[model samples]
Target: MNAAAIDTSTPRLRDFPYRLRDNVRFGDLDPNQHVNNAVYATYFETGRVTLMKDPQYGLMLPGFAWIMVRLDMHFRAELRWPGQIELGLGVARFGRTSVTCDQVVFSEGRCIASAQAVMVLIDEETRKPAPLTAELISALQPWLRRGVKGTRPDLA
Candidate 1:
C-alpha cells in the first residue's frame, strides 16, 4: 500500500523507534541550492538498512533477504546542505510475507520529508516471498510506529 493509505500525523522524530543522524553534504544539493529530491530516498534507505542489517536486531536470517517493493515519499519542507538530518523509521504494518515501514527526515526539529516503504522477505534459494516467523514478528513489535495500529491481533 502507498503512504497515502497510512496516517502519519504531526511528524516527530521521537515517534519513530529507529533513528540515525547524518550530515547533508554539499554534493547532495541540486541547482536549486537545496537538497535534491532524489537524495531524500537515500537518506530513507539508510535508516531502513541500518535497522534491518544489524545483528542485534534479529531482523535478518540466513538464506532470507529483505527487498523493498515500494516507497512513497512526501516532501514537506526545504533542506539546505549546510546542516544535518535526523532519520527515523518504524514498522507500520505486517503481512504474511511483507512488512510496511514509515520513515521520516527531520532537520532542526522540522519534518523535511516522510516516506512509507513496503518490503518483502525473500527466500534466497527460491527467490520468492517468505512468511514472517513468530520470532521475527516479536522482534518487530517494539519498532512499531507510535499512535498507529501496526498489526492484527491474529497476525503472527
Candidate 2:
C-alpha cells in the first residue's frame, strides 16, 4: 500500500509495535547538512532486521530468508546529525509469501519519514518465494499495525 493510502502524514511512533532508539551519526549527513535519504533506508532496515533476526522474536525461520522486494519512502523532514532518532515499524499486511510493513522515523518527536516495505519469504536454496508458515504468522501477529486484526492489543 502507498503512504497516501495509509494516511501517514502525521504518524505516531507509539502506533508501532517494534521500536528502536539510535543516534544520527555525523557521517550520515549529506552536503546539505542533513541526513541523506539513503541513510534513512538503513535506519528502517535496522529496525526490521533487529526484529527479524533477534532470537527472542522467533520470526526468522530456518531454511527461509526474508528479502525486501519494494520500499516506498516519504521524506517528511530533514534529520540533522548530533541528534537522536527513533525508528518504528509494524506489519501492515500479509500475503501468501510476503509481508508488508509500515515504518517511520522520528527525531525529537517529529516524523522524519514514513515508509512501506514489502518483504518476501524465500527458500534459501532455490532462492524462490516460499509460503509463510502458520507458526511464522502467529509470531508476527504481535507485530502488526495498530488497526490490523492480529495486532497486540496491549500495545497503544
Candidate 3:
C-alpha cells in the first residue's frame, strides 16, 4: 500500500499480543537526522525474538531452528532519535512448517512502521524444513490474529 493509504493515526499495538520497547540511539540516525530505515528491521527482529523465546509462547523448539524467509515493511513516518519505539507483534498466519508474523512500530503513540515476516521451522540436523509440532501449534493459537485461519491467511 502507498504511504497515503496507511492509517498512521491508529495505534495498532493493541492488535498485537507481544510488545518490545526500545529507544532510538544517536548511532541509529542518519545524516538526515532521522532513524535510519534499516534500523526499523532490527527493531522488528527484537520483537520477533522476544516472542519466540517466551516460555509462554513455546515458539522455539529443541533441535529445531527458525529462519526468516520473507519480510515486508512499510514506513509511514520518519522516526527521530532520542525517542522510544514500541514494537508489537502477533501471528498473522500459520502453516505446516512456517508462521507469518505481523508487526508494527509505534513512537509517541503513532504508528511509524508496519511489517510482516514469514519464518520457517527447520531441522538442525538436516537443515531442512520441518513440520510444526502439535504442542507448538497449540501454544501459538492464542496469539493468532482474529479472523486469520491457519495454513496461510491472505495477507493482502
lDDT scores in order = 0.90, 0.89, 0.83
Please provide TM-scores, in order, for all candidate models, with all chains considered together.
Answer: 0.91, 0.91, 0.86
The sequence of per-residue lDDT tens digits that candidate 3 reaches over residues 1-156 is 554354344446788887788888999999999998998889999998888888666778899999999888888899887899898988888777888888899998989999889999999999999987777788887777655666433334
Give one digit per residue, the lDDT tens place, for model 2 in 1-156: 564554645888888999999999999999999999999899999999999999898888899999999999999989898999999999998888888999999999999999999999999999999888888888998888887775222212
Error of 2 at 123 (Å): 0.5
Instruction: Flag clash pairs in model 2.
Output: none
Clashes of each: 0, 0, 0
What's model 3's lDDT at 48? 89
Runs of candidate 1 with Cα error greater than 4 angstroms are: 1-8, 150-156
Worst 10 residues of 2 by lDDT: 147-156
Model 1: how far is 50 from its true place, Å? 0.4
Tens digits of per-residue lDDT for model 1 on 1-156? 453455556688878998899999999999999999999999999999999999998999999999999999999999997999899998888888999999999999999999999999999999999998888888888899887674542355
Off by over 4 Å in 3: 1-11, 146-156
